[model samples]
Target chain A: MADEAHGEGGGLSFHPMDQFEVKPLFGGYDVHWYTITNVTLWLALAILAIIGLMVLTTSKRATVPGRGQSIAELMYGFVYKMVEDVTGKDGIKYFPYIMTLFMFILCANFLGLIPMSFTTTSHIAVTAILGFGVFIAVTVLGFVKNGASFLGLFWVSSAPLPLRPVLAIIEIISYFVRPVSHSIRLAGNMMAGHAVLKVFAGFAQVAAIAPVAIIGVMAIYGLEVLVSAIQAYVFTILTCVYLKDALHPHH
Target chain B: MADNTNAAAEVAAGTQAGMPQLNVGTFDNQIFWLLVTLVVIYFVLSRVALPRIAAILAERQGTITNDIAAAEDLKAKAEAAEAAYDKALADARAEAQRIAGETKAAIQADLDVAIEKADAEIAAKAAESEKAIADIRAGAQDAVKEVAKDAAKDIVALMGGKADAKSITAAVTARMKG
Candidate 1:
């Protein structure tokens, strides 16, 4: 048992690659930097593949849409409908942004499920960046559309004057924390799920002599796939909710 | 101080024994690269892909509108043709009714003329029959008078005297006077 434990620890200690690392491309330049990660390359490849698929599927524009076209159309229509439902008639203008976000996130999440792949979304920095971008966009749009009235979102004018200040303070804090919470939520969920899967997979490798551990790994893998897709959908729906608030600044 | 140095030596040996160390500041680099990727994706979607999709949608809308317009025109034409056919049918019905009425009037007039001619022929036949009856009665009365004269002449002959016109006339006149 001790020997098996040592072997397992040795396997766990192994790092796929250590030489290729993120570094400053130019000396003393903070801007225009890049990381050499398999995840980044895979993400780019996935985006290109998805875009190509969309193009090829819809190129023919047949009356009876094929399976590929149908799937593409379904994704497009889903995002479009989601925006329409969330933001009403005026939301159609933002369909492109919402669709792009949904597609990119969905592809990124799915790509991570492949063997020997990295999930960028498991990192807090990546999620934080995306969430911050949404936060800025929504806030700017709200102010642009509603002007001074956008501040009313923090103050509950319907409430009693004595309670209004407290409510406003709470609302302001929540508003500021929106991006942080959003980023943390997705990142934490993805990271924890992947970590658990990796641990379980490790256990299965070490306990391969026991058939139950192998079954456990397979079951967990299935669950991980479900979790992967659910997390992507959750992330997209939250984005839509934020967009909704921007499009209509009213309660 | 000696134990600390020994511990530092052991850590250095462990580090050299290939305990992989992640490069510091890699997270920041990952964020930068991700942002770059996001910008490129946004640009591609906004400039190239989105415009193409919009164009295709507009073209589809145009095609549907044209189809609807053509269908409406065909429907209008069909309705007009149907109305014209209905008008022609009504006219033909009216013409048939008028012709039937004219034929009925002409047949009625011919029937009246034939009845009047039959009445005139019957009247003429009745008049001729009455004249024949009056002539037959007059001839009967003359025959009666002649029989009477013959009987008187026979009586005069029985008296054995030559009958003369004047004596016969006187005897007849005397009997008529008595």
Candidate 2:
């Protein structure tokens, strides 16, 4: 990762995109389906963080919560309320799935912010699974729960009779584009933020500009932190919205 | 995968150029680890962490409810005790008033009986004293008549003229009676 930070004149020339490199941890040229990579390590770190807070910290399960326990309970209640408010009480049965997705992405995003850490959510491969999973599950559930009437979602019966066909086409396109937008939105945000951070960090390699580059990195890092949490919230809330549509297709 | 990493290695070792994150080569490893990590986290959260947290929240709720119920019960008990005390105090005051009234009436009744008895004794004493005075008056009159008859007999003897004793007696008794 550091190799690309140097350029021709032996003076520091920055390669901002090099921090995203995927290399084998054991030093190899070939990456297989089973290669242990930096991505694996960081993904594991995110999981460990979740367990450390949710399981290890809350092991006592005191009624008067400790700090970690409080955070865990807060997160649980926050997501639970969000799901309930967005989808109503009927959508609560899927709380576990939604909660899992939220925690995973949230942990991944925040963990990725660590200096020299690989971001799992920044990859399309990771975000695609989560986004597509929600899209497919919501589609299947809508059809199963509403039967053939599920098609009413795209029909827009409220529109004028003359405009109904055109409106349905537009709705259908938007419906199909849900997964693509969902996945790319998260990936793009994470990728863009981290790439910007790298660019600023690379600028610090020059002795004269090092101080300004570090300050810029710090300011952007703060914004990225906010973005990380907001993105997770966006993803979870969108999931709830899709669920609401499935359960109440007419609305 | 082989070509992508080969290019990355070549860049790191030789001429530096390539964004390995876009290399599509390590997608397999990243995806596999992601699945493993997410699956484990989901299980832990759903089965272990979430339940424990839920239990704690429920326990706190239950504890608060129980505390409130206990407070309510204690408040009721205190109120009942105060009411009982007030009732007892009222009853005691009423009993005291009744006893005072009964005692006053009893003392009054005893005084009335004593006054009646005293009045009757005074009347009896007066009647006896009056009878004694009347008897004394009669006795005194008889004695005076006897003395006057003796004096008259002595005067007649001294003068050498004799008077009848029965007449003297009759005269003296008549005068005293008048």
Candidate 3:
């Protein structure tokens, strides 16, 4: 598809963005609400991967964990410790939500790195839901925990009184922009990395530059692996940070 | 050249699909699956995976705590045992000293009694020797007085003077008595 979209003449060309296109799994251009597309397939695969890695493998519940169990336990401790450190001990109750979000994004992102995989995290729709979910959850939690005083999150009493309104306005805008920025950061990073990989791969079609293109693709592929894992960590830690702000808004 | 033109036209058609990710129609599909999958994952994590892992951690913590407690118990027991051993050793040492003191006192008491007995016997013997010496001096003096009376009578007879036996005896007796 990359070549088909990029090549015009008998010369070599590449369309890096074509790899991000979500198409229906069946032979249909119309992706209806209930249509099973490549996104749906990959989403299912990610879920299956989650079940296999976390549930099925960890069911043994050994005190001394085996390999699969250790991975599951390590991920569990990682997210658990992160939320605790970021949001304090009281933040432990929300650990399941944070762990779920991390595992989903991490699983999806890593699954996308396969030779012919679709990066689910590279989509706005997916990351937007996660980001907006965090925004809405933390907002509601702040209100519920702090009552109407949750608006104090925007009011900076430390600043001069005359400048409070201006600061509050700025705070409100930034607060609303959080989900947008959060979602875009993840989607943009994942999409850009994969697109770059596709471009390098397309360049491999050139006889004179095949070796250079292959090396570049290899190098970028390694970097994307790191990026994929790091983005998941960043997203999860940011969620904990927001949760902290909600739980302890005065701080 | 005609084939290349057709190929370019086909490329234009492909581009007409226009970034399928931006297609709003696919938003519903992805969001729906995302919600479903996320919900399932949350349940699995909260209800299944997380609990098991937490149980493992808690179990390990419990085991470690119990082990430490048992170790402390054993340490205390060892200390108590050591204290008892030290106390027993001290008591035994005290008992040995007490026995040695009693034995030394008994020996000293026996020696004191034997010395007292020997002193009394020597005192009795010294008094008997002094009484014997007094008796010998008295007897020697009486014998010498009797001899002097006999010698006085013999010299009187040798001078041819008349000597009365009764008078001599009386005089000699008187002198010796005095």
- TM-scores of the candidates in the order shown: 0.63, 0.76, 0.73
Residue range B56-100, candidate 1, lDDT tens digits? 556777888999999999999999999999999999999999999
Chain A vs. true chain A, TM-score per candidate?
0.84, 0.94, 0.94
Task: Write candidate 2's Cα lDDT for A1-251 as tens digits.
Answer: 44444534266555555556666789865667788888888888888899987898889888888998889999999999999999999999899889999999999999989988888898888898889989999999999999999989988888889999999999999999998899889999998899899878877888799899999999999999999999999999999999999998884
- Candidates 1 onward: DockQ, in order: 0.10, 0.32, 0.30
Write model 2 residue lDDT over B38-75, tens digit each, in one string. Answer: 78888988899888888889999999999999999999
For model 2, the superposed segments whose C-alpha errors exceed 4 Å read: A1-10, B1-19, B96-178
Q: What TM-score does candidate 1 reach? A: 0.63
Q: For candidate 1, list the clashing residue pairs, or say none.
A: none
- Find the candidate with the highest lDDT and give its number: 3
Residues A1-251 of candidate 1 have per-residue lDDT tens digits of: 22233446764432222212222333332322353555467558666856775566777775456887667666776777788887789878877777767777777777766765676676676788889988999899998998988888888888999999999999999999999998888777766665555555556555554476567667867887887778777777788888778777668
- Ten-residue stretch with the least lDDT total in model 3 chain A: A1-10
CAPRI-style grade of the A/B interface in model 3 = acceptable
Candidate 1 yields a Cα-based lDDT of 0.68
> By descending TM-score, how would the candidates be arranged?
2, 3, 1
Off by over 4 Å in 1: A1-35, A61-65, A88-93, A140-148, A206-226, A247-250, B1-24, B79-178
- What digit string (tens of lDDT, one per residue) describes model 3 on residues A69-155? 989888988998999999999999999999999999999999999989888999999999999999999999999999988898899
